[model samples]
Target: MIWVAIAISVCLGAAGQIFMKIAMRDAGPFPGLIGVVDIARYFWGAILSWPMLAAIVSYGISYVVWLGVLSRADLTLARPMVSLGYIMVILYGFYAGERMGWERVLGIVLIMIGLFLVVRSGARV
Candidate 1:
């Protein structure tokens, strides 16, 4: 059950990141950091975007599930598990037409290796 919550949290976190990326895909370049009005306008646009709303909801669900996970597991174990989100986000980004350079592929490999080590270490105890 705790593992299920952990998995849900990781998936939700990744989904939230993907949705936020989608929401910002067409937002153009940032209008500099000089004006409050420009910032407000940007935020208002984000608030009205369905992808942003979905990201918010996904984060909320992830947070709730994370709370449940914390109650059942050590923070050390659970925190590393969240790194699984990086793998999911990378895959989703690839599916979304983003370029996947060698660096990113290496990063994904390292993350997978780290996750394996962490999980393996946990199993030893």
Candidate 2:
């Protein structure tokens, strides 16, 4: 129940990040402090992208589920659980052909260790 909701929230958050990345694949470099038209064009393109739409929906659902999770679990415990999204997003990004440097790998490892410690401490409560 509560665990399921937490899992769903993490997954949805990761999915949203992946979808956004995919949607931005073709969107060339940012126009750097450009005109309003450029900004509008960028946002319009994003709004029309199916992947972006999916990302928005995924994030919306994740937020709702996260609220439910918080209602049942302590914030100190549940917040660290959201770090699971970092691991999932990194894996998905690597699989999707994004750069995977050793630094990123090390960061992921650190996040995993932190998450483990948090969960373990929470369980003792």
Candidate 3:
């Protein structure tokens, strides 16, 4: 059950990142450090954006699940597990027409190996 909650948190975090990336596509360049009014307009646009809304909701639920995961698991084990989100996000980027260079592929492979080892040792502790 703890592992399941951890997975939920990681997956939702990845989804949130993806959604935010999508939303940012339409958000023109940063409003800059000009003033609060410009910043508000930029933020208000994000709030009204559907993809941004989904990202916010995803992050909200992930945070709730993460609280449960932290309560039940060791922080060392749980923190590294969050890297699983990196794998999901990379996969999503690939799916969204992004190039998957060899370096990224290698990085994903390494993360998988590390996660496997972490989980194995954590099972003993």
Candidate 4:
């Protein structure tokens, strides 16, 4: 159960990152140090936008769940489970319009296999 929660937290965290990337796509990079009010005013629209808001919410939930997972599971067990998010994030990136070449796809597949091997190793330990 603790491992499950940790995995879920990782998924939420990955999703949050993806949402933030989508939100920033049109908004451009972080602005150079300008007037305080100017920077604040410019980001006010983005901070309140749906994608940004979703990222915030996802992060909040992930933090809470991670705390719960840590209380029940050893860090070693919980942390490795989070590697699943690499696979999740790669898929999300592809779905969100990032063009994935064959090399990237093969790399992601290798990562998934590595994650599975790690899980099998944990069973032995």
lDDT tens per residue, model 2, 28-86: 66677789999989978976899999999999999999989888888888888889999
Between candidates 2 and 4, the TM-score winner: 2
The residue ranges of model 2 lying beyond 4 angstroms of the native Cα positions read 122-125
Per-model CA lDDT versus the true structure: 0.88, 0.88, 0.91, 0.81
Give per-residue CA lDDT, model 4, range 1-125, as digits (tens).
Answer: 66678778998999898888877875677787878987886688678788999999999999999999888777766677777777888888888788899998898888778777777775531
Candidate 1 overall Cα lDDT vs. reference?
0.88
Q: Estimate each model's TM-score.
A: 0.89, 0.89, 0.87, 0.79
Q: Write the per-residue lDDT of candidate 1 for residues 25-117, one digit (tens) a residue.
A: 756567789799998898789777999999999999999999988887988788998999999999988888899999999999999899888
After superposition on all C-alphas, the RMSD of every candidate to the true structure, in Å, is 1.9, 1.8, 2.0, 2.6
For model 2, name the residue pairs that clash. none
Kindly report which residue pairs in candidate 1 clash with one another: none
For candidate 1, which ten residues in a row score worst on lDDT?
A: 116-125
Displacement of the residue 17 alpha carbon in candidate 3, Å: 0.6
Runs of candidate 1 exceeding 4 Å displacement: 123-125
Worst 10 residues of 4 by lDDT: 116-125
Cα lDDT of candidate 4 equals 0.81
Best of the two (1, 4) by TM-score: 1
Superposition error at 12 for model 1 (Å): 0.5
